[model samples]
Target: MNEKEIQTEIESRVQKKLSDLFTTYKTDTDSLQAILKWKPVVLMIGNYSSGKSTFINELLGQDLQRTGQAPTDDSFTIITSDGSGEGLIPGSTLVSDEKLPFTYFKDFGEQFISHFRLKKVDVPFLENMAIIDSPGMLDTVTEKDRGYDYMRVLGEFAKLADLVVLMFDPHKAGTIKETYTAIRDTLPESSGEDRIVFVMSRIDECDSVSDLVRSFGTLCWNLSQMTGRKDIPRIFLTFSEAMAANPESYSEWKEERNQLKQKIQSAPEFRINHILQDIDRQVNEIKLIAEAMNAVARKGRAKLGNTAKFGFAVSLFVFFFLGVILKGMTGFPEQTFLAALLGGTVQMHHFFVPACGVAGTLLVTSLLFTKWTFPRLRQKARNSLGNLITLETDYRKNLWSKVENRVNELLKNMRISEIWFEHQTNLGKIVKFLNKDLQEFYERIRKIK
Candidate 1:
């Protein structure tokens, strides 16, 4: 089949699998639907004068973003293709428009809302993906004075972004404090490390190839300290034509720059894998909740079983104590079945007395177990959910933390007595999505070139 047909089939099967989960488990998937509404986004971030805007202008062959050396732009701009060509939208309109995904940016307040905008230019490459050019990362400590958390906002964008381009230059050498904090604390929090692409822009400004090497080494050192990874990640050495060239060694990195651009062009395909991962993570959350409930249920059942046994034993003991009291007080036989042994005579006609006593004990024990003991055990289990977090395995513990609050909400709105679901029922559905639907979709994508 053609690539388009294969992609359509894969998407159809994915949606069907999601629908099946929604039907069986009653999960909320409005968040996932919201994600699919927007185009795959390539987010560009860097310090001031880092040639970010210049590089984007080269990629689309249009000066879509305003570029200057001294922090010329303070707003976050979204550049997308428009068939009509050259349309500028203000932040207020950008968020308020029902078709856009920036509605959540309203929480950043009117100040940030004023700083966000959308630029539409006629470009065919933008048909598959959109680009976000953010205000340059500054190392200043006056963010509270600015009335917004800059890194926090960037972190949110990183979470939704398909490919995040972190542009640096030889001048900064990765010592941008704000950039370090974003990489150290913010980006990792979003769990989008695999989507990050590091680029050292304006290497032409380094004067010589040896100077460029020194700057690159400094960047590697700083990145190692911040990310705490022993292995060094690949960083593209790139310079836009707007900067002066190192005439001798300029051609050395001629291919790396083109490869970086190629990576940007390939973002839409990367978005497919990201979407699948998001769905998988969501479904796995449901599985975690189901698994936790199942574990709690197993423990609850064991408690009920013990309660049943003990209750019956206590009832029999009480009956025996009552017979001893009668025998001591009025010479009534303790063992009605063996009354003749205790006395000197046998009464075969009095079989009803012993039979009735045993039958009554069993009936009372059964009633107490169902009406009092079992319900109380369920209540106790529900109350101690935090303690019941089956962290026996690493995967369960990690997944449990991700879905902990959701599980609490589920158990809160649901009946604890019924939280224990049939394991294979919900689990089998998850397994089907993972092993069958997802695998088939991936195979189809693989076959499509």
Candidate 2:
């Protein structure tokens, strides 16, 4: 067979395997259908205030996403093809219900509140692509939660992307290494290395044009080498603020941005189409695993049932034998005649005594062993199976966690936001005080390429 034919065969086999696995779980066929009908989802991820929301707005040629100086605590804004985007807010249902032009986070005080809104302009982008604005990685929240959010979004993004665009800011003195590592780590293993793209934003903030170009070039090279995609296109640079605030100052940047847009527009529409194939593969795998688990459970239940049946049969035999013995043991005239006719010295009174003893012993044994011992054993087996399930869940969670940590470590070095200290007591001061070594560590990353 030819190379293309071989690839098709392999994909078909994999898909069949996944479908077989998933079938045991009783998952709906339609659930897999949604995944198959994947759209190109672009996730804008970076540190808080790294111009992610702003850049998204600029890309759609409108202020669809909320942009401000305040730190956005909530991370996810899902813009889909339906002329709407949903923001998953933390506390209030109202925030979740309100429709805004784009999703954004605004400061509420010591507690960072999350809000979701909808916008119209992002709808067109969503027709072919789902634009996701993620929460900033370096917010003051717990690293675990941030990591979780990042990994979740990354997984979703991976499923949707024909290409991934990694956005960065260069004016800040920090490393791009961490960001690059995050992008690399979060990418799905199923995706070949050629699908990711890098973009450096806020180029207008750089000291000089040469510095911007040099930094961007170095970042592109380092990222390419690290990710083992040396042949991928160079990182694209843009002055997003200039594009937003004063379009005239950076016409070149604007042009570059447009070219990137063209690239996206012109790229092959295979990713979404390929997702249908992947869904088939995953379904089969899920079905297979579920079937195996079900088989084990059924076997265990059947074994216990058989043991119970055997005990019941033994009890009935003892009861009948005891009645026969009792009749022979009785010294009554009628009983003696019956015993004589049977040609046996059946002791009417004694017969029952020994038979009952045997019956009682058997009953005790069966009750003790089957009712108590066997039940405990069966319970242990069930528990073992349950533990296995738990372990499997934990294993998947750990794998996802590792991926998230790698991504977060990369984001920390990107210097996506600044800590303003107008008042004597700002949270940034506290962060700086605690993370001295970590900050230095990230600073070193800035010089890598």
Stretches of candidate 2 exceeding 4 Å from the true structure: 1-18, 22-34, 37-39, 81-125, 139-149, 172-186, 241-250, 264-270, 273-449
Which prediction has the highest lDDT against the true structure? 1
lDDT of 2 at 349: 60
Question: For every candidate structure, what is the RMSD over all alpha carbons to the true structure, in angstroms?
Answer: 5.0, 17.5
Estimate candidate 1's alpha-carbon lDDT, on a 0 to 1 scale: 0.70
Clashing pairs in 1: none
Question: What is the C-alpha lDDT profile of model 2 across 1-449, one tens digit per residue?
Answer: 33234334444643454333233233334323443344455556655566778876766766667766555646466655555554333433423333421112222222223333223343464666666676655532454543344444344444445566666677432434544455554443344454565677777766666877787767666666666556756666766645355545566677777776765553335443334334433433333333334333444445556655766676666544544555567733344333443777655563544456556766776566545654564446444433323325433343334333322332232111211111112223323322452233223333331
In model 1, the Cα lDDT at residue 234 comes to 84
TM-score of each: 0.76, 0.47
Show where candidate 1 strays beyond 4 Å. Answer: 2-15, 18-31, 140-146, 171-194, 221-231, 245-249, 318-402
lDDT of each: 0.70, 0.48
lDDT assessment of candidate 2: 0.48
